[model samples]
Target: MRVSLCVLLPFVFFAQTAQYTKDIEVVKVGVIFFNNELELVRAFDTAIRDINELELDVRLEPLKHFVSEDDSLTLQEFACELIDNGVAAIFGPSAKASSDIVEVICNTTGIPHLQFDWHEENFYIHTRNHKLTVNVAPAENMLATAFLDILHMKQLDWKSFTIVYENSRSLGRMELIFGWRQVHKAGIKLWHFNRGDDYRILWKLVSSTREKNVVLDCPADIITEVLNASIYYNMTGQFNQWFLTSLDTHTSTIRSLNSRQFIAKMVAVRVRAYMPPPVHDEADVF
Candidate 1:
């Protein structure tokens, strides 16, 4: 998959106004992240390395800070520190609360801010004045429409289906799907899963409902637990069709959770266009 940073960085630097110096210099780019976002940090580092290889006059340096997503004061401090250190742009703190704090600071300081988190369309409409901020997440309605298209192509008899989502934020991603349910008068059921909840109990309830079509929207970290619970409940059979909304669903960890039987019945959407490498002969599929 093409890392968004790889594409966005060039535009960010080249679009600078005449007020900024045209002379070659080392440009510092700030990154704000949570503790669990090491993968994102690694990706950011890789992107910076790849960009530097172009041998452009402007060299790029990354300044990253790890902060608690809920710590508004600390996040604000970090943002100010990055700006004080002369960063041209800031990326992430993908969680909504922290992102808002950083975005406000960046806006006031006239520094560019970029995000990779999903947000409702109205957010952009309301924050039109914050022209320095850019979000690369796909629009909710667009993603919902894509999901509908995929369902249609699969030709599944999904008159009724259960939507199992991770949190309140995930609900925003489902708005268009909810509208579709209303329009079609489909029997749609909703289930919410929090991090500490018993996965077995959740899957048991779902299994008891005998719902053949299920849509799961959750972070990649918990997918294995969720699927393991479903498997324990015999919910991974050919008759059950699962659609996973996480882009990381195609990762090796997730793919390893599927046997041939499970693979045939499950569908996962990812950002990349490429298909996964074929399962190996000796490797355990489950």
Candidate 2:
């Protein structure tokens, strides 16, 4: 699960080997990301060390820019600064709106912009001309296909399931699933719920529905809350089955639900493993 990454942050250096032992070129790259996700920063740091050890002709000099979720102006300002400094590429501003602004700058400036996130909208798939934007996240179409395969593997009649999702991102995933209905042959029902303190209303609707098959596409925290409500509403029983869209479900432990030994069929998607970029030693570079 601890995969090395370079796509999350903008790394815009040419991958060329040095012509001679004396030639050394250090290319500057900019990484714009949220202040949170310190874990990603730490993981990227290790990736940097590995890259540096490669001793490629074009060494990477990373310039990090951290921004808040609400500050669109600051995100633009950071992109401007990175451009002014002649950075080869710009990495993030992980929020969708901010990322749009950053991508415009990258395209206009002819710099490659790398991004990593669950791209449900297909915004980062490709461009008509510049092709500057790149997303490292798995494509929504691929994920949709994988889910269908999972359903078939389980030999479950998942065609009549209800989709319980949280927020716009989850809805986007739901759309991906529905868009591929010709292949899946599933008549899916959708329910959208915002993240909040109370899930009683949502639970009531879910419990009242005749469909015992449920597909959940939400954050881990929201998943926990929904499962709690499912139990309270007496919705977890022999006739029901829950299919989780999140890869991290196996890692999640709902003690209350587990203690009751609710035996309704349950299954989850496993997260896709990420591979780090390849690194080469000085000799290999030449």
Candidate 3:
């Protein structure tokens, strides 16, 4: 329904120092993102128009970059830059660990920071820091709720359902595992967070397990692998529903695959809160 996130600064330090606001000419909102999200980055930069539209006095300044789970040092190195640069407001450090790192930096430096909802738990862990923090969109529950709607739509029995997920350093990996458990604890036949094994070899479990419906929290690479395996292993016909995590953008994912075949199989968390209007160009944040 409704949720709020505020980017906050530490009170203890601020109490001793002069109010940090006077020196800055305009509020600067810093964003950190992945290299692959170039188009999405550009969409974020279109805030030139968003600023024009919202009429807010301050505007956003994105500091975008690529981060992998393996690159914690690089992430922390950049986190220090945001801290040293005195970013008046920082919007993101992107990944959970990177976001966590930035949250610590913000806590230490008393910088106000906000990240788009990856999950409420993510918000919960950092909200304690007392920085003005908010979740701009529905997190875990949005997917689980949409799934519950689909079950009702299909007239599907709850006992036939199961979920598969991967815990490979991605956001919605085990993030949704907890949400799924909390939301649907009963009549759930089975649940798993697929280890990053070669999926095709391990997927005898899919063929052997409850075959009626399966929902997954896997990325596009894993999803594509599982789909190919299902088609190859002859385990797909009985499925009434399948869920794909929002690990990849819909348009980009569609560009590579047969749109018609995937049309019914894909689901994603489409967050449109900051979207201004249909007329503006979308690639400015990159």
- Candidate with the greatest TM-score versus the true structure: 1
Q: Candidate 3, which segments miss by more than 4 Å at Cα?
A: 1-27, 34-43, 46-59, 64-77, 96-99, 117-124, 141-143, 154-158, 168-196, 245-269, 272-286
Kindly list the per-residue Cα lDDT of model 2 for residues 1-286, writing each as its tens digit.
1225443333323563235433658777788778886756776667766777874666778899888877888988999999899887776655344346787778888888876556446443345433787766656767777776666653575657788877656554455556645422346777778778478788788777676888877766457777877776666788888888875565466444765547677777654434344653211210
Model 1: residue 263 alpha-carbon error in angstroms: 4.9
True-structure lDDT of candidate 1: 0.72
The global Cα lDDT (0 to 1) of model 2 is 0.67
Evaluate all candidate structures by whole-model CA lDDT and list the values in order. 0.72, 0.67, 0.50
Candidate 3 accuracy as lDDT: 0.50
Error of 1 at 117 (Å): 2.3
User: Candidate 1 residues 1-286, lDDT tens each?
Assistant: 2245334744556435212776746788888888777777777788888777874667778899988767888898999999999988888777455346777787888998877766545566337545677776666777877777666653565778898888767776676667667532457788888987899899888888787888898887788777877877778887888878876665537767757546437777766433445633221122
Off by over 4 Å in 1: 1-12, 15-22, 96-99, 120-129, 182-186, 260-264, 273-286
Candidate 3 residues 41-109, lDDT tens each?
A: 565556434443543333344455566655678777876776666666566644444346667777778
Report the C-alpha displacement of residue 48, candidate 3, in angstroms. Answer: 5.8
Residue 106 displacement (Å), model 2:
0.9
> Which model is ahead, 1 or 2, in terms of TM-score?
1
Question: How large is the C-alpha RMSD of every model relative to the true structure?
Answer: 5.3, 7.4, 8.2
